[model samples]
Target: MPFIIGTPIPDNKILVQSVSHIYGIGLSKSKMLCQRAGFGDDSRGLNVTPHKSKFLENLMDKSNLLLGADLRRFQNDKIRKLYTIMTYRGLRHKKGLPVRGQRTHTNAKKRAHFNTNVS
Candidate 1:
């Protein structure tokens, strides 16, 4: 059986890489999660017994880390806040341009391109 985290089921393979499939869990965090769950980095997800899998599930539930839909909602809320504030970044996002001060002269031509088609 596959290990389900949030909406995704991780395939039975390297434990660290499997865990990293969930949102907000990077390589380092996945490694730490594997260590915390008493599994070796190379341990296969399929090899995890029900008891160990339950423990891991509980650990994930208790952690502050966001996953799947929750992570998406959180990010959307952040962007919404930025838009509401009308800050410089918000303006850039509103305009569909690069928010981080990238040169718009040439590199951001894709973003700067306007739809020429008229109804």
Candidate 2:
């Protein structure tokens, strides 16, 4: 059987890489998770035993790291707060412009195009 984390199993990937399929988990974190789960770095996803998978699931549950829907919800909430506060970043988000002060005149063509398309 395939191991399911935040989503469907990535049976074709190496176990270290496969764990990164979970939202919010990056390559470094995935490697850390493999170590903590007592799985070797070279382990393949299909070779993950039920016990190891369960151990991983439990570790994720106990960790502060958010995955999948929870991470999305947290980000959405943060953006909502920014929007509600009417900060500069919020205004940029509302206007569909770059928020980090990237030069909009030359850069952010995609965002500019998106704004124009909406009208």
Candidate 3:
């Protein structure tokens, strides 16, 4: 395993896949990063070289991209704001119910009764 942007990825992970271990970068963004870093399909990096790591750090800094703990904190802050605002979704979230308007008539059976004996 190796660390990129403070996230550990499997040693054998593809270059594009390796970059996606960071919280904010998805597959598409990872491909873009690999291309920008000149890491091609053949670059089976055993580990990120110091030069490559430095380049990536600079790129992320220039792009103002948030990763890892920073992204998690941002997401948590947004959810916490919703809770403080008492939004319908926040109430639903607090109740452990579907917050996306999902039908609950046949699904949220917290105390469903079942017959136990054959007549």
Candidate 4:
């Protein structure tokens, strides 16, 4: 398994999928990264040689994309900011409920179950 940005790439997965295991990267972005790194569709994670991996890493570094833990931290900070401002979405997050206008009339029972904070 190759480690990229402190995340492990599953050797059994196809290269693009394995790359997508990294946070903030999805299927399309992973495919683009692989294409940029000169990897083909059939490439597996195990085929990521040190040089190729380095090239991939360099590509990620050079790109202005926010990724991995930094991306996660940035999102969390945004949520935290919303919470400080007491926004509706922040309240929903604090209540452990769906924040995107999801109706809690019925399907949100599971979320309600975890919402121990009453009022």
For all candidates in order, the CA lDDT equals 0.76, 0.81, 0.73, 0.89
After superposing candidate 4 on the true structure, give the runs of residues whose Cα lies further than 4 Å from its correct spot.
Answer: 116-119
lDDT of 1 by residue, 23-110 (tens): 7778888788779999986798677777887887778878877776788899989988998998988777777788898997779877
Clashing pairs in 3: none
Kindly list the per-residue Cα lDDT of model 2 for residues 11-105, writing each as its tens digit.
66788777888888889988888899988877887777788888988888888877888899999899989989989887788778899979977
Ten contiguous residues minimizing lDDT sum, candidate 2: 1-10
TM accuracy, model 3: 0.79
Model 2 CA deviation exceeding 4 Å by range: 1-3, 115-119
Error of 1 at 69 (Å): 2.0
Clashes of 2: 0
Q: Best by TM-score, which number?
A: 4
Colliding residue pairs in candidate 4: none
TM-score for each predicted model, relative to the true structure: 0.78, 0.85, 0.79, 0.89
- Which segments of model 1 are wrong by more than 4 Å? 1-3, 111-119
Rank by TM-score (best first): 4, 2, 3, 1
> Sorted by lDDT, highest first, which candidate order results?
4, 2, 1, 3
Model 4 residue 34 lDDT?
98
Identify the superior model by lDDT, candidate 3 or candidate 4.
4
